[model samples]
Target: MKAFTTLRTTAAPLIDGGKLMANVDTDMIIPKQFLKTTERVGLSEGLFHELKTLADGSPNPDFVLNKPAYKSAGVLIAGDNFGCGSSREHAPWALLDQGITCVIAPSFADIFYNNCGNNGILALTLPQEACDVLAGQAGGGNSVFEIDLERQLVIGPDGAEHHFDYDEGRKEKLLKGLDNIGLSLQQDSAISSFEAQRKLATPWLEKA
Candidate 1:
């Protein structure tokens, strides 16, 4: 898990009266045809690209994301275990490219959460009540929100705030944007020291 920290990003206003779309159905919001065109890059253009408008440049007014308030959103108050049902790192990549710095949810799939952190995106897990409050605020125009992971607080549109605590370890990885490989490399000095000590202590075991 990565370190968590307070982050502020523009939130995507969710419409349709708090409708919840979880698991694979979530990808329908994006689509696979666009997924194959690029690899973890250039995905932002494709993200919400189809759902946002028609080939004729007409807005799909019915789509939640296409709503006037959500068109330029950079964050999402998502359903539980979002990014579940698959291990596609592209999901977070697309979100990141679109300028979304974080996601607030009641829960998240383990791999997706990790992938988000690895790519410098924060994924905050809050209680359902807290999420509802955020979702409610999201329906407004350009609803900007902030999540302070260290303090476990969510700051809303009216400036009212709520708190939700998370594990200590997960917090650190996110703050630093360290993936597993990055974390391991951070231990390079310690690993080298250990190897030097082992060579002296077990000389007979070397190359034997």
Candidate 2:
């Protein structure tokens, strides 16, 4: 998980990316069959699998992801309550594998937000009006966006900026590429000292 600083892209605008899209649960992002593998690398194959493909396994030309403009999209401006349903860390993994680093939406499922932090994905929350504006811009397919996590700002194609809010600690963790395990490990020395004292006080515990 690399540190997330900024996402600058001049690629096609990410229009219709669920601005009206609702209830995009974990299963909708990646189907159950894709869950068979613990490895994250190949999960992109299943990202929006149902929407991106037909029952015959052919690419759905009408889907947003299959469109040529979004083929290389890095930032996803999404709709309200975007990541709903099951708590699957694989959801963000699949998105990242598909080259999407950030997902900005009106709201998100709580568990999904936590999973994103753990895996180095940026899940941004903004007002619905702001998201609608971004969606309109992206729908045009010619807009660009610069997402600066360090500054907590989204620079639109028109040079207008939208400020967002997030926990200061979580922001630092993303900027420093620190997951929960990494955050915990920061206290390794203190934890080790406590363990050493515990062993001294209860020698039989160490024997076990």
Candidate 3:
């Protein structure tokens, strides 16, 4: 996990609503069967194809990102309550694998938002109208966006900006790349010291 202070990058518009998965469950994105594979390439080759495509193999163009503007969208400007659905960590992994580092939306599902932060993805929530404006800009010929996680601002190409807020603890975790497991590991020294003290006080407490 790395801290997120700011990110300025090009925008690829994914305009479809209600179909795009956010903070998706990892299992659904890449089943266990594909988990152990050594290669990290082609993760996006079938990403959402099964859910958003047809049997004959043609793309479900109706899907938000099937359009040309969104072909390789790296920053998703999404809709209200984005990332709402089943709780799955794989969802964020799939998005990250596809090169999306940040998501700007009006709102997000709690689990999905947290999963994204844990994986170093900046999930931002703003006013619905603000998101709409950003989405529109992304659709128009290679738009650029600058997101300063530390300052909590999303700057658009035309110079307009939107501000957002997040939980301080989660922000710090993302900044340091510390997930729950990582956070616990950070306490190793203290935990060890506590165990040593307990052993001195109660030697019999140790397993025989």
Candidate 4:
């Protein structure tokens, strides 16, 4: 897991992810064609692929991500129920590959939210009103936004801040860069002790 504390980045409005478009699934995020390979490389090119390019593979100048200002965007401001389809964790992987470290939305799909936590992406939920404001401001020249995990606040490019809440367990794991395995490893001594006791109790089952 990547340690998360404070991050400041240029934001890109996730205009078509699941809102403007009809149900953006994991395939849309990474596309089915790109799913065969397990390697993380080349995943960035798949992020918003359908919208970013044409059938002939030329760039769509009108898309938010295709624009110069948003090319390096690390934060995405999206609409409600973002990541609504498919439980594949590939969606977050694609976003991370493209340098999107934070996603601000009114809501998110359950599995996608957990996947993001496992993979070190910040999924921040704000009211629809707040999302609207952030989306509108994100395309401007500065497009900068700051996310502070410790303070649980999102600082807008204009310097105004909005507070957010997250589960305490997840928060601790993120702050410490712990994924599921890492979390379990934190109780290594306990697990080892339990295993030792179990082996002793079932001695007959042990292999020579």
lDDT per residue (tens digit) for residues 1-208 in model 3:
6566777776754453632234433454455544455454566655565545678978886665566756666687766676766666666777777777798877788888888988889888888778777777775447778888777789999998788998889888877878888989999999999999999999998966
- Worst lDDT run of 10 residues, candidate 3, spans 18-27
lDDT, each prediction: 0.70, 0.84, 0.72, 0.84
How do all the candidates rank in terms of lDDT, highest first? 4, 2, 3, 1
Better of 1 and 2 by TM-score: 2
Q: Candidate 4, residues 1-208: lDDT per residue as tens digits? A: 7899999888888675434332456666777787777777678888878888988899998788888888788898877777877787778988998888898888888999999999999898999888878887875547678999989999998899999999999999889999999999999999999999989999877875
Winning model by lDDT = 4
| Steric clash pairs (candidate 2) | 18-21
As a whole number from 0 to 100, the lDDT of residue 5 in candidate 4 is 90
How good is model 3 by TM-score?
Answer: 0.79
Give me the displacement of residue 183 in model 3, in angstroms. Answer: 2.2
Evaluate model 1: give its lDDT.
0.70
Alpha-carbon deviation at 4 in model 2, angstroms: 0.7
Q: List candidate 1 segments past 4 Å from native.
A: 1-4, 24-26, 35-39, 48-50, 53-59, 64-72, 194-208
Which tens-of-lDDT digit does each residue in 1-208 have in candidate 2?
A: 7899998864333334444575678898898889988998999999989888988989998877888777787887767787899988889999989988888888999999889888898899889898888777776455678999988999988889999998999999999999988999999999999999999999998777
Measured on C-alpha atoms, candidate 2 has an lDDT of 0.84
Model 3 clashes, total count: 7
Could you tell me the C-alpha RMSD of candidate 1 in Å? 3.8
Backbone clash count, each prediction separately:
10, 1, 7, 0
